[model samples]
Structure formats: structure tokens, C-alpha cells
Target: MLAFSKLTKSQASYLFSFGIVFIIYLISYIISPFTSNDTPFYTLIGRSILQDHVLPYKYIFDHKPFFSFVLYGVWDALMPIKTGMFTLLALCCAAGAATVASSIWKTNRFLVFFILITTGAAFKMLSGNTGVLQIFFQILVLYLLQYPSFLRIILSGVITAFAVNINYLTAECLSLPIIFLLYHNKKIIFNIFFFIFGVFSGLFILFSPYLYSDPLALIEYFQQQKQFLAAYSPSFTTRLFTVIKLFCYVLFFIPVLYVWVQQNIFQKQERIDPNSILLGLWFVSGLIASCISGYPFEYYYILWFFPITIMIAQIIKKPEKNFKWFFMPIAILTLFSVVDSTINNIIKYRNIHAIDYVKMASLTKGGSVLNIRALQTHFYMADLKNFDPYLFKEHIDIAFGSRAAAHYMHDLEQKPLSVLLPYQGCEIGAVEATVCHYLHENYQKIYEVKIVKLSGKIDHFSFELYKRKSGA
Candidate 1:
């Protein structure tokens, strides 16, 4: 403890920020390494790129954009499959926390504490999606506020554009904020021209390799992405729940917004320009995108977590009146949400327990395995193949009637030797059940594995092993 005193305030704060982030990740992922479908899907995509020497459109599903698969390729090259992904995910979360902490240091020293807490809680909902890295990039856009130069402005555009490759929604959320900045600035054309140049160069640098590797696949990817978006139609209840979730986020910031108004408008103490309104618009755009996008996956919340947290932090540092009313209640709610989500995720994934991944590996030893919404990651971990490219629900939707489903069904024409029907429901509302029924008739179920909770409760799910029947 005496040795700790030797460090300066900034040094100590850095250590604290990193320690909090590290602990958050370590505890969250101790048992359940695979957090979401994204982890396996991306890993499988990376492996497909490595083995096939092409992008992963054939073996796995990916719709983000061109450069996303490129990063997965880099991920594949740098690390082993399962363990590597878990470690990388932890590192990304830590990096995001570190980025936010570092960004807050110059503005308000104490803000790092709130930033870490908020980011940790908010990020828990993601379960380590590309959102972690994307949030870090969004944080970089905030830091651009400090060194507002021609160079920095240009770099900001580049960074923002580059972030789109990570996830296209970021561009949707941030583009308006960039326009707002340019409009607010004294020089418009200068910033716009340089910003456009930087953005073009960055896009070229990021996207060129993907085009060179497989332009046709890249074109098909965008087409599929559009089709998926056009096809998505969530339930009215689902949309209502999503709006409520976004409102909860907005509610969490009520105190901060109140404080900002009191300080800037009522008190007239500070002139925190364009950025004051800038980050607000950025946050709003993200929420708008999340709401309107038809699919309301919770991780979409990660898009604006940085800007909103940073804005709240800035206001929290200097409030006109007692802000505990806001902080304490929101703090309690955020903490509860964090813990609750974390626990549910643990229980949800707990059934994916360590009870013989090798047994399933032996079942799918040689040929490509169709995951059937089961342990797709486990199959990838076993170094077996997922021959069917249609692993996602969207693909299942497209398969029912659309021509787009042909790409996915193309490989299935051969009827692979092994199949895994893991979920008990086997309920693909729109996906043609006849296709699955055909498999049942043609194949013989050789083995079964039940997925039961630690409390001795069966999840009503079983992982079945199937082998093809002899030649008819």
C-alpha cells in the first residue's frame, strides 16, 4: 500500500480504471467464454477465410460490411479459435473502458469512476459483440474534440468512416454529428473537403483488400444485407419493449441533462459549445437508428453508450444543485440491470457447460456440421465444418420463399453425413419445415445429449447426433 502512494494522481486513476475494467471482464467471463452468437459466427467466419482462402459467405453468415470480415481474418491469424476470441474480447472491453477513462481525464478527473461504472454496466448487455471495439472508436471521435485542428478534423472523419467497417450503424448515428460540427465551425468548405478526402482514403485502405479477395461475394453481402433489412418485421409488442429499453437509457441521463441545463442555460457559467449539443445529437441518432431498424437486438445500445456516458460525466462533475437524487437512483437501477443481465446470461449459457465438447466433436469428426441453432461455436472449436451457410434466423427467413435463400441451400443439395438438431422447439416459423423433415427421413438419429441446468432442471433441449442412411 505504501508503494501505491509514490504514484501521481493521474497514474493512480489509470490503474484504478484498468483494474475495474479487468475485474468486470474476468468475473463475467470466468465460466462462460462464449457470450453471444456473434463470438462463434465471427470466429467461424475468420476460420472460413483462412481455410478457404476467401471470405466466409459460403461456410458462415456475415452481413456487417466488407472490412469486418477482414478484421476477423486478422483475428484468426493472430490467435487460436476459442481461447483467443475470449481473450481478445476481454482485451477489447478493457480497451473501451481505458479509452473512456483516458478521454475523461482532461475534462474531469473524477469522471473516470462514473465512466467505468456506467460502461461496465451498459456493456454487460452486449456479451462481447463487435460493439466493444465500436464503442472504443466512438470514444475516439469524442477525443477529437480536444485537438480540433484541420488535421484532427480530417482524422475524425477518417476514424468515423473506419468505425463503419466495424459496424455500419455507427456511421448512421455519427454522420449527423459530424455535419453539425462543420455547420457550427467558422470554416465549412475547408473542413468538408479534407474530411471527405480522409474518409475516402480510409475507406479505400480498409475496403480494398476485401474487394480484391472476392468482389462478387462482397456485392452479394451488401445485397443480402439490404434484403435482410427489407424483410425484417418485428412484432408490435417487441417494438414497444425496445422503445421502453431506449427510454430507460434516456431516463438514466435525466439528471445529467438537468444538470447541463442548469449550468449552461440557467446559470450561464460555461460556454461548452457545439460538443455539448453535438454529443446529444449523436446519442439521439443512435437511439433513433436502434428503434427504427426493425430488429431491436439489445447490443445496439452499445452504439451511443460512449457519447451519453461522457456527456453525463461532464455534467456530473459540476452541478448547480444536489445531484444525488439523480445519481443514486440511476446508479441503483444501472447496477441492478448490470447484475441481473449478467446473471441471466450466466444461467442462459450455463447449460452450454463443460460436459464433453469432445463427445460432440467425435460425432461430427470428419464432415461439415450444420449447427441447427445449436453449439455452432463448439463445432468450430472442434475444427469441424458448418457446411450450411445459413446459420442465422434471417437466413432461415429468406430460405422459406426468397431467391436469396439459394446461396444457403446450395450446399445442402449434397446432404452432408452429419446433422445437429439441438433445440427442442425446432420452430422456424417461416423456414420450410419440409426441408428439416426431409433430413429426418433420410438420416438416422444415433445419439442424444440433454442440456440441463445446474439445478437439475432440464431446459427441454437436447443435442442430437445424426448420420446419413445408406445409399437408397
Candidate 2:
């Protein structure tokens, strides 16, 4: 009921900026090209939660923290939409963009442009990776830290703890940047003390469910997670890509240094450069995380988005006026790339249906459904149980993957009711002789679908749905 005329310029500007950010992200999600295998992988955990009325820590298989799975569970209960994840993703990115817009300008054009460019990359490659969300939280903390207030510091600490629960690698790399931030506080001791205290406070919230269920179960979960990631360190090719991406990210900072020097040296101004140093640390942390990631996939680039965009904001005096013509071509090119990706996704992102198999699964209660490399999105949609609780099935199938997978597949005496093989990437069934032999002996192929994805040429995939014999 409030009138617009009654509002101040700041309020109106804030709302306008929020609207712009929201629309950009909304468009990004609407035109998104692909859904990650990760989407349904996490969805399976949510289904487990709904059935069990508690987190399924008993399935000591996956490495990710338990917090995200709980939120996914709550989301499905309320929204119950397949693409609901898109909304969650867009909202987080929008919030971060809005924060930058509020400080930088009405548009913060460069920041928005950066997000659109990289967001397309994310949808194409890192769609369901947690790195994007982690950057969102990191930006939020970055903004809050600008004020250096006691309350803000504590809140930053709490949010950071939550961020770590999302992805241990990216957040851990931020340690030096955080230390740099703490050094700038007026009362360093008090802020550091409270920050650590707030971190423990956040940790309590993260661990409460496990503490309530069974204390030792938490330790067991940690062991299982470690057993899985123990062999996940980067390979030679991964490390090479990490170096290349790091070099590319460093190029973005030249403008930041240009701005920093212009303001401090040329203008003959004397001021602390803590923000610059912190921003540099932010970039370094991302490089470190990428190096540590067993595979420096495209998604890892998401971490660099935070520091780079923030640095751009600091560099441009008037984003719209400064960026008017120079960035116009870049903007067009970025959008074109994204649009091309969208078109490619529409044509190439194949969804090999398994309706008949899911329906058959429904008929048989207390039956396990095995999904090979293809994530079992359908099983979760039907609220069915997974044969293997380790939802990140690809990692389990890879070279030097978790030993638990070896033990789990050691005996195939009791085969699953339904098995899905998308016969595409990795084809672990072709590599693992024991598993291949077991499938050959017990399961029979009942349904097959051949789908063609054409980016440049036709890439055909044959999906085979298998069912065990009546009394196999």
C-alpha cells in the first residue's frame, strides 16, 4: 500500500537494482541448456530423507556434507518440480548480483555481463556443481565484510562455516583471505575471537542432526567420505587445465591493478589496499582449489567468478557510462555464445526416458534400482530406493575410486530389480569385468532407446534398461 513517491532515492535504487539482477538471472535460468547429472544424484538423497524421516547417514557412500541434502529434501516437499533447482540457482546468483549492483550502480553492467557469460558455461558444464552457490555466499560475505562491524563479522563467520559445509575445497582456500580480513579489524582480537566462536556456532547447527541421531555415526560418515576422496587428487591433464585457467583468471586482474594504481599512485592518495590484497587472495584461493580438485572441470571456474566480478566493480567508476560502447561488443558476443550453448543444449541434451522401468519398479516394492553411470533421476522422482547408496556413482566407477564400491560390487548374489545403462561415457560396465560378467549372467535387457545428440555431428547413445528374470 506504500506509495513510490514516499520512498527515498536509496530505496528506489535498491529495488530497481534488485529487479535488474533478478531479471538477468531469471533469463539465464529460463534459457539454460543442460541439467547436471548432479541434480538427480542429490535428489536421490532427498527421496531417502522423505522415506526415512531422517538423514540417511547409514549410506556411507557420498563425500558432500549433509546440509545440502536436507535442503533439497525440504525443497522437494514444497515445490515438487523437476526444474525447481533452476529457481534455487537463479535466486542465489541474483542475490549476489543484487548485492554488487547495490554498491556499484543501478546496473553494475560488467558484473551482470560476467555472470551471464560464465553462467552459460556453468549450465553447459557445471550445472549442478556446488561451486556456483559457494561463490554466491562468498560474495554475500564479501559485501558484509565491507562494513567491519562486530555483528557483520559474526554473521560473515557463520555464513562462511555454512559455505564450507557446501564445498570443503573452495571454502578452505579462502583461509588466507579471511586472515587478511581479520587483520583489518579495529579490534582484531575481539573480532577473531567472535569469528571463531561464530564458526563453532555454525558447526553446531551443521552437526546437530548427526549428534541427535548417533554421535559415532558422524565419525563413521567422515571415514566413509575420506575413503572415497582419498584417491581423487588431480591428474596430469587436470593439473594442466588448472594452470591454464589460473593464467586466464589472472588476466582479469590487470584492470584491477590498473585501477588500484590509478587511485593510489597517480592520484597521490594515501590509503590502505587491504581490499585489493584480499581480492588477490580470493583469486589465489580459487586457483588452489582447482589445483586440488582431482579434475579441474569447467565448473571450477565458477570460484574465479566471485573475485573477478568484484574486482571489475571496484575498477569501473561508472559501469554504464564507462562500459557503454567498449563493452557493447563483448556483451553481444557473450550472449551469442550463451545462446549458441542453449541451442546446442536443446538439440544435444538428451533425456533417454525410463518410464516403463520406473513403472515396473513401482510394481515391485522393497526392490533396489541400479543406475550405471547415468544418474537415476527417475527413481528419485518416483521416491524409490537406490541399489547403491553412494549417489556419486561416476566417482565410484573411476580408476582408483572409493574402495567401498569394490566391496559393494564384490558379491552380485542379489541383483537389482531394475538396471539402467546409458552406454555412453566411461562405460565402467565394459571395464569392470566382474560387474560385466554379473550383468551378463543375471540380468536381461528388456527396453532400449537410441537418442542422437548433434552439436557438430551426430553422437548416438544407446540406453538399455535391464530387468532380472522372474526367479534369477
Candidate 3:
């Protein structure tokens, strides 16, 4: 306690902020460690990359760029598979808390407290996706650019490059340098040169494996990425509705918009704060980036959490009399939403717990298992290996069409072990037509159990395990 007393106020504030954030993350991890499919998928890829010492896409399949896997790879290297993800989660929250605390520690103490708590709650909803690292690096880049220096500007570019590699959706943040370049008056030319140089250097380092090991592979990767996007791109109506639906999730920003109207219009301030402009730009860019995919996954909204939190903090620091009425109710509602979502996620993932790994392992005899629209955690827990390249089932039919389905059927012919399928109303006929046909002909259903689903038409669905028939 004497050592604690010796620390400065800012230092104490940072520790307190970190403690709150880390504890929130810890509780979320304990109740629902794997909140979404993304957690197990990314963690499994990370584990494979660390153990095999090669990029994992060649073995497993994922369209996410390389750096997120690299971060996970490093995390998985230091700890065992089951718990390594929690350590990463803890570290990410710690890093995010430090970033938040460092940026606002000297400002209004209440604002600092508010941002830290909200950011912690927001991070809990990330569910260990690449968005976790991607958003962190993007926020760090913005923080660095918030006060540009010779080194800080260059570092910002490099960090943004890392963010882009972690998740290509972060490319929207690349425009942020333009905002800084306009505001920065000193050594503009040198800043431009340095930023570009840093970006190139970061890219070179990230792609070095393909650069040196197999140059042709880089070209192939881009081609594959292009084809993948083209295959899955939704129509205009889908994208439009998606944008409208997601916008409702961010109504807390109405207060920020209200503040902006007051400052720019009602009061007619001679000069607007550049930092306000910067924050607004970053928030809008994140929204645009998320909209580009057209898949209405709620996890994508994780990008909005930090910027919105900071904007609200700015409001609270010097709130207007009328702004309080708007902000307080919205803040309360947002808090309720965060708590409600966390509870729902915990309940949703608890359903995945119905998969009994001991029975699965016994049924498969520790052999390769083909999982179709099933939880990936089963493979990770059972230490099972997959012989086929089509490890990922999503978009396989859309992206690769008949050929991919044919290949999956061909793998079923080998029939190394059990086949796991989502039990849709106990009628295998209703599932993917081609695969359903093959499974019925070749495999015999051994077990089926009810699995709860939170966000679908039915509250419960069945999960089934199938073993290959003898002499067939």
C-alpha cells in the first residue's frame, strides 16, 4: 500500500482503468469463452500456424489476411490451445485499457472513467475475432496521429498497415493520414515521405514469407481473394438494407451529432476542433468499411465502439444543458444494450457446450472427422485432423460451386472417421442437397442430440454424428 501511495495520480488512474477492463473481459471469458464461431476458427488457425511454422491457409481455409493469424499464432505458442485464447483476450483488454487511459488520463477524470468502462464492455462482445486486433491497432494508429511527430507519424502508418493486414476491412482507416496531413503544418513533405516509407516497410515485412519462399504464391493469393469476393458479393438491395439495419445499432451517436450541430450551426464557432473532425472521420470510415462486406454480422459493429466512446467522452467533458437530456437517456439505453448482448452471448454459447467431446473422441477413435456446418471447437478439443482441404464450409458452394461439393463428397468416400452435421428437423433430406444425398448412401447415423440456437427460426436444432458403413 505504501508503494501504491508513491505513484502519481495519472498512474493510479491507469491501473484502476485497466483493472476494470481486465475484470470485465475475465468474467466474459469465464462464462462464455467461445462466444462465436470466429473464436474457435481463428484460435485453431493460430494454433496450427504456431505448431507447423507455415501459413495455415495452405492446410486450412480462411479468407482473413495473415497478420491476425500471426498474432494468434504467437499467443497460441506461449500457452496451450484451450486457455491460450483467454490469455490473448486478457492481453487485448489490457492493451486497449492502457491505450484508452493513456489518451484521456489527464483530461476530465469522469470522462476517463466513462470511456474505460464502456470500452471494456465493448471489448467483451468482440468474442476473440480478428476485429479485436484490427480495432486495437486502428485506435492506436489514430492515437499516434492525434499528436503527430516525426516518429509517431511514421509509426502510425506502420501500425495502420498492420491493421489492414489483420483485417482488410480496416483499409477504410487508411484515409486517416489525409486528415493528419492537412492539419500538420511542419515538414509536410517529409511527413508524407516518411508515412509512405513506413507503410511500404510494414507491408514488406508482413508479406516477406511469400516474397522469399514462393513469390508466385502471393499472386495466387490475390487472385483467389478476388474470386472469393466476386463469388459472395450480395446484390444492391441486400447491401442497402444491411446498411440501414446496422445504422440503428449506433443510435448513441445521435448525441455526438447533436453536439456537432450546436457547435457548428447554432453557436457558429469560428473554428472547429480538428480532433473532432478526426474522430468523426474515423467513425464514418469504420462504418463504411463494415458496410462493404454486406454480411450483417453484428460483430462488425465492434469497430464503432471505441470512436463512439471517445466522442461521448468529449461530450461529457463540456456537455451543454440540453445535451444532458439527450445524452443521459441514450447512455442508459446503450448500457442496457451492452449488458443484454453480453448475457445473450453467454446463453448462446452455452448451447454449444452440448457437444460432448468425450463421446465424440470415442466415436471417431481420434481419427480425421469431417465437420459440416458444425462447431469447429469439436475438432480443436478432440485433437482431430482433417485430411481434406475444404475445412471451411461457409461459401464453399457459393465460391467454388459444384467442384467444391464434389470434392467434399469424394472425401466422404475415404470415410476415415465420423461425419458431423447439423440436425435440421431430424430430416437429413433438407440439408445441402448433394452432401445430404452422399451421406445418406454411405454413412449411418450413430447419435443425435438437441442443440439450442438463439438467433434462428427454431429455438432448438439437433446435431448428429455419423460413421461410415462397413464394407460400403
* TM-scores of the models, in the order given: 0.81, 0.78, 0.82
Q: What are the lDDT figures for the candidates, one per model?
A: 0.63, 0.59, 0.65
> Which has the greatest lDDT?
3
Candidate 2 total steric clashes: 0
Off by over 4 Å in 2: 1-34, 54-57, 100-128, 148-151, 249-267, 272-277, 314-316, 319-333, 348-366, 376-378, 381-383, 399-411, 424-434, 455-462
Which of candidates 1 and 3 is the stronger one according to lDDT?
Answer: 3
Q: Per-residue lDDT for 1-472 in model 2, tens only? A: 4688897999899768655654554454444322554555665575566757556556424567776666556555665455536445545564565466346323365555445344435334235456666676776666666667878888888888888877787465677778877877678898788788778888888788779978887788787777666666557887787688656645544545455445533555576466656667777787677667756465666665555555555556534334445444434434554565544444423442423546545544577767665545545545556666644546555424545345446534557787766653225343365665677678777766555544442233345667787778
Clashing pairs in 2: none
35-103: candidate 1 lDDT, tens digit per residue: 675666676676666667656465566566655666666666776544435545645654565555455
Question: Candidates sorted by TM-score, descending order?
Answer: 3, 1, 2
Higher-lDDT candidate among 1 and 2?
1
Q: Pick the candidate with the highest TM-score.
A: 3
Among all windows of 10 consecutive residues in model 3, the one with the lowest summed lDDT is: 104-113
